[model samples]
Target: MNPNTTVALPQRGPAEHDRREQIIKAANEHFRHYGYSKTSVAELGKSIGVSSAYIYKFFESKQAIGEAVCAQYLGHIDATLFAIADNGQSATSRLRNVFKSLMKKGLELFFEERKLHDIAAVAAANRWCAATNHRAALYGIIERIIVEGREAGEFERKTPLDEVCMAILSAMTPFSHPLMLEQKTPEELEERVVAITNLVLRSLAC
Candidate 1:
């Protein structure tokens, strides 16, 4: 190297990004094992080999970390629903698939990861940005399906699109909302979800 030639500085961006991800991953595992409400930021830091202050550098508070973890879980469901919406199936079929997938995924979180589900419930109860965004994404998916059905001449266009979408969401609330999922067994939800979805589909038919 020539004397006085400037050496490229090591990039902190990727390392900082990796550190932030590591914090989220560790917090997720901690929350899953111990539950989000019970786990503190100090516990999370200890689990991840970082100080509480350092973790705070990546997240504003324990609730912020919980939001990140909740977002990760909800994001998976959103992606799955989006894929179903875009599939080449008839709009009716895609709409039905979307309802079924939402119920299936909600039940999975409620039953399989009971503890982790608390974070989601909290997010919803507080109208946290993660939960709000997830709901919007779901609504968008439903709207897309509805638009497709109308364009295909399979569904009535008489109903205002917003009204139809809201009606569908309200009908599916018991099966799709995290807190509401607690009211019934998986079997009960399955039976009712099918009935509700079919009812909505019939109402939409041209």
Candidate 2:
């Protein structure tokens, strides 16, 4: 019976969201350019023209900022895979689209945004077990697609789905590894991804 006892709250508008994104973007650039070890909160804040205390308001620490950047990168991959899966295409077509998008996106992030790629690589290597878990989740998405394709009789393979999934992920390793990606031109790397993907498809197809 206390109608007037309701509390009012402030709404988070687009501007606040945009400012947060800007801070993250600036942090990502700094981490990428200087490597995570060299990047400091004061330097990042200076780059964004905010005080170190203000940076803390957004992210608790540099490690937290790095994790957020990595999450953003993985989010893009998840979105692309889900979009392809939702399309009304054949299973094979969807699978192919996923690989193509993966390769293209990987190349863009590795070559064009080389600094960010390096930062992520260093983080993942140092955090091996956590990185492996993250990778397993990513591969689980791909495995689901394979399972659907197999159920529809679109994919034919004798291997267990988990094995096939590991193979698919193994094929993508070069793209994620900075040393490997560094040794090749973007075109060459793209070709390598396509070749490996084709091999996996051939093994899986009827």
User: On residues 113-137, what C-alpha lDDT tens digit does candidate 2 reach at each position?
Assistant: 8777776676576653324444655
Best by TM-score: 1
Candidate 1 residue 21 Cα shift, in angstroms, is 0.5
Off by over 4 Å in 1: 1-16
Location of the lowest summed lDDT over 10 successive residues in candidate 2 = 1-10
Per-residue lDDT for 11 in model 1? Answer: 23
Residue-level lDDT for 85 in candidate 2 = 80
Task: List the candidate 2 regions with Cα displacement exceeding 4 Å.
Answer: 1-25, 32-35, 45-60, 128-134
TM-score of 2: 0.73
Please report the TM-score between candidate 1 and the true structure. Answer: 0.90
Q: Candidate 1: global Cα-lDDT?
A: 0.83
